[model samples]
Target chain A: MTMPSVSDSGLATDAAEGSVVLERVTRAFQGRRVLNEISLHIAAGEFVALLGMSGSGKSTLLRALAGLDEEVEGEGLIRVPTARSVLFQDSRLLPWESVLDNITLGLDGPDPAQAGRQALASVGLAGRESAWPGQLSGGEQQRVALARSLVRRPQLLLADEPFGALDALTRLKMHALLRALVGRLRPTVILVTHDVDEALALASRVLVLGNGRIADDFRLDLDHPRHSDDPRLVGYRQRLLITLGVTESA
Target chain B: MSAEGSTLGGRITSSTPRTAQASSRPGGTRLVPRRLTPLGRLLGPLVLLALWELAAQTGLLSPKLLAAPSTALITGYDMLANGTLLPHWLASAWRAWWGLGIGVAAAVLLALASGLTRIGEASIDSLVQIKRAIPTLALIPLAILWLGIGETMKIALIAGSVFVPVYINTHAAIKGIDIRHVELARTLGLGKAVFIRRIVLPGALPGFFTGLRLSVTSCWASLVVLEQINTTQGIGYLMNRARDYGQTEIIVVGLVIYMVLGLASDAAVRAIERSTLRYRKVIGS
Candidate 1:
């Protein structure tokens, strides 16, 4: 298989610090290849959105980057930061634990509680420390999940459809919150999502997976606060949608 | 019928105003009545007792067959006054406590073994299932042969019966813990001890409580049977002696004590369950 190398256009100075480099990474399940000898590179502090159909290996790729697929049968090298966190579709908070406890779970430091409180405040949820996870709204639970991820001060943030379960309005609010948090934290993020607009809205670079490989990789240089109505974004959206096998008549 | 339908429709359309008026009223009444109050629960038993007393007084109920409630109460009072009931009650209670304690401890240990490890499950689960098919009461003859009809034999039988439910439920609960949570623990880099304490233990608690409730009832049940065998100390012995002398009132007293103890212990376990699992969105709470 001829390996195609996907690289960032610029920002290579701090490449060794928080950058991701995959060299012909391949993953298989039950003798069926999911990620087939794919090579890619992501620069430090880049927000990369991964778009794919249901079985297009977006989550498989993300899981590989998160070191979650160690037991998975794969042949290749995935270089991601040791300090990384994953945000799942569901909040995945332990219901038995309080909000602060969920955030501070497995966190070791002089005062993890203080860091947890700060993380909670950053997610706009202060003073909800003692509340149970079940008591929180769906959006609030996701926010707590975001807090838990950020509390680790990860260099890489891997999110698999974090806003997938939220209501449309809540999803919009979360997009804004995530954008702001990412702006401040500056982690190299790889978000796996099915929503094209979500990818364009938050990510600096978007990659579409098809046929167990990177079918299309687009560097979205479009500025932040990029609206679906924006002509440039509309252009990108149309192209990305067509690539994703969607054809809109209008 | 059309006119009545129109009237009902009118009422339905005016429901908003009616609801507003209801809300505006001081100390608004509940739309749904509470399931049961303390007094309400006692009413059925009280009425039954009243009927029984009336029947006995009217000579409809034969006193030789079964004692009247008043006769049984007087008999119980006399036993308490003469200190006979206390010793017997203490002996029964002691046996029950020991059996339950030993059984529960063994159940927890076995459940942990089977639930946490594949090897333990492979080794222990099949044996327990086999034992479950054999009734503890049926083992009395064998137990007497082994332990010689002493307090040890009685307690061993009670413990043997009590262990099954607790083990089954706790093991099931441990196995039933969400796989996602275990994966979450792995991602969080939680150590084995931390994982067990935070995830496994709390996850199994509801199951353990369920098992405990069954075990509490089983303790009293087995104790009742165990006391009847070659024993002169427990409530079963008292009942057995009363049966020989044809003291129907004393027998009734023994039955009443067992009933109260069973109810009390179940209530205690439920109270503990309620407090510990208050986070659950329980229906009818």
Candidate 2:
């Protein structure tokens, strides 16, 4: 199935150097192709959301880009900068280490603690360096994870259903924090999620993957901190839902 | 899942949620304070002692078979006064201590090699399995022949007894490390030394502690058989002497010392567990 291409209205494509470029990337597992002949160019500072059904190769593509899944069959040229970081569904904090130590983990600097503190403060966890990961709530642990990722100041950030485990209210609040942080950092980001609203709420450009390829690309030129109730997001939401093969009723 | 969850600090999206709780201080790894002891624990031992005393006083139990608590206490005091118990107690303690030291060292080294390296595991694991099957006390005859029924034979017996438990526990602990944590180390590009220091050692500590407790008990248990290896020193020697004279009170005294030593070592391990594993308690009740 193929999606009809929409006009790229108000989408700025001038003088933006590509930070990540994928050329004919294909991945297969035991004779079954998951991602096939995928190609894309993500400019610096652009936030892209990858929307797809389960097993549609969204995560496989993401992992391939991270240089983790190198078993691709074809000449798939994936160019990612040295400065990059990834966040998973769970916070994945080292339970043994304190909050601050987790942030400064693997980070080399004259004063990693100070840098971790600043990162924690940015995530609204100013004095929580000494607390264990188990002490914090789920959301707070994710915040520490965010601080750990941002502590390195990576140029590219990849997220895979980070808020899939969070509640609606927490998810909304996290959206705001993420938008604020991204606006400040100006790094290119590729967010992979099954949640269409999340993509519409965050991504400047949303790509829908189907049959191991990008089925549709929707460019939302909305302002920052877009709400779920905004009329501008309604059309994109409907299109995404239909593309994801969700029926109105069973 | 956000890219921030990646240990490698790879590509991530900034669109994830941030409703994380920043303040619940639940699972801190601070030193945990000891809780109050329940009365039930002391009650059991006291009741057992009282039952023995009652039976002895009523003559329902013969003194030859089992000495009364009062008789044992009086014998212990008399031996203490005459300085007969001190030398035996000292010798037993020394043997147990050295056996534990040597066994623990060898076990840890072998466990580390077996746990971390395939070659080490392949070479040492089968041999250890064979050693584990044979009770260390069964080697008494061989040990006596090799080391001449002196301090060497007794110490070797205790060491051999402790080795298997220590090795099994330590090796199992090392192998039982969570795969995710190892992935985290690799993603972080941690060096071998740093990985061993930061991940391997701390991860295997609880297992090692468990093994240490077992080693202590086994070492003490073996000391009984070891000191009997034609030795004229230690509590075992004292027991043999009492046996020759048929002085059951002195024998009872020696038995009580061994019991106390076993309990003391067990308590020491518990204390270490409480301090080192305090982090596990930090989770909200």
> What tens-digit string does per-residue lDDT give for candidate 2 at A141-197?
888888887888877888888888988998988888888998898878899999988
**Candidate of highest TM-score:** 1
All DockQ scores: 0.47, 0.18
* Docking model 2 quality class: incorrect
The candidate maximizing DockQ is: 1
Note the Cα lDDT for every prediction shown.
Answer: 0.88, 0.80
**A189 Cα displacement, candidate 2 (Å):** 2.0
Pick the lDDT winner: 1
- After TM-score superposition, the amount by which residue A111's alpha carbon in candidate 1 deviates from its true location, in angstroms, is 0.9
lDDT of 1 at A245: 92
In model 1, where do residues sit more than 4 Å from their true spots?
Answer: A1-16, A69-73, B1-38, B42-44
For every candidate, how close is chain A to the native chain A in TM-score? 0.93, 0.90
DockQ of 2: 0.18
Give candidate 1's error at residue B249 in angstroms: 1.8
